[model samples]
Target: MPNTQRLLTARNIWMATVRPNGTPHLVPIWFIWINERIYICTAPESIKARNLRANPNVSVSLEDGNNPLVVECTAKLLDKPFPDEVVRLFKSKFDWNILTDDEYGALFEFTPVKWLLG
Candidate 1:
């Protein structure tokens, strides 16, 4: 199981993925922890989404204030899309009610390949 407690309260993390040309792309994203999974959502057409599709390898960092623990993953967008549980949890925890149904349709789900609490 993931270190659910730590990740759930983490304010933000730098989500890093490799670009097609071999450089890293990093962006700060808010994430939610559910069950044994760390769930994050992003537009399916985003650059990071495209990069992830090209190379499923990704890394996310959660910090204890300024100190960071990095988790690595190889993610695949779920064919079935985000389930209602995910949507509810996401909105409840993160206040993401901004997304309309059409926007929500663009979401993708990712799972961690590995996590390192350093």
Candidate 2:
């Protein structure tokens, strides 16, 4: 793993997956590393979730050391609608007090399986 402070203190690049028709879907997302994996909160029925279900195969890239490191693998739903504790945890990271329950629910949960972080 890259030095959390050295490589990630200001890093924002994250792995984003999507299905672009017949072609493979892949893109980099700007994210925050929560707990042990990079995360994003999205609706379950969103395109991203659909694509992940149809094709678990995935790829990710993260800043490692002094350069960008890439990983190819799959992801599984570790959590959805994030648990209350998880939500509170993430909320602490941002000004979540202003958000309503439904607004907060818009953020979901996941974890990287077979991840490769340099």
- For all candidates, the clash counts are 0, 1
Residues 13-95 of candidate 2: C-alpha lDDT, one tens digit per residue = 55556575756655444344556655445446766666776776666666444675655546565534455655564466554
Q: For candidate 1, write residues 1-73 as lDDT tens digits.
A: 3445677677577888899899999998777766655566677778887888899888988756466577786
| TM-score on alpha carbons, each prediction | 0.79, 0.56
The lDDT, on a scale of 0 to 1, for candidate 1 is 0.70
| Most accurate candidate by TM-score | 1
RMSD of 1: 2.6
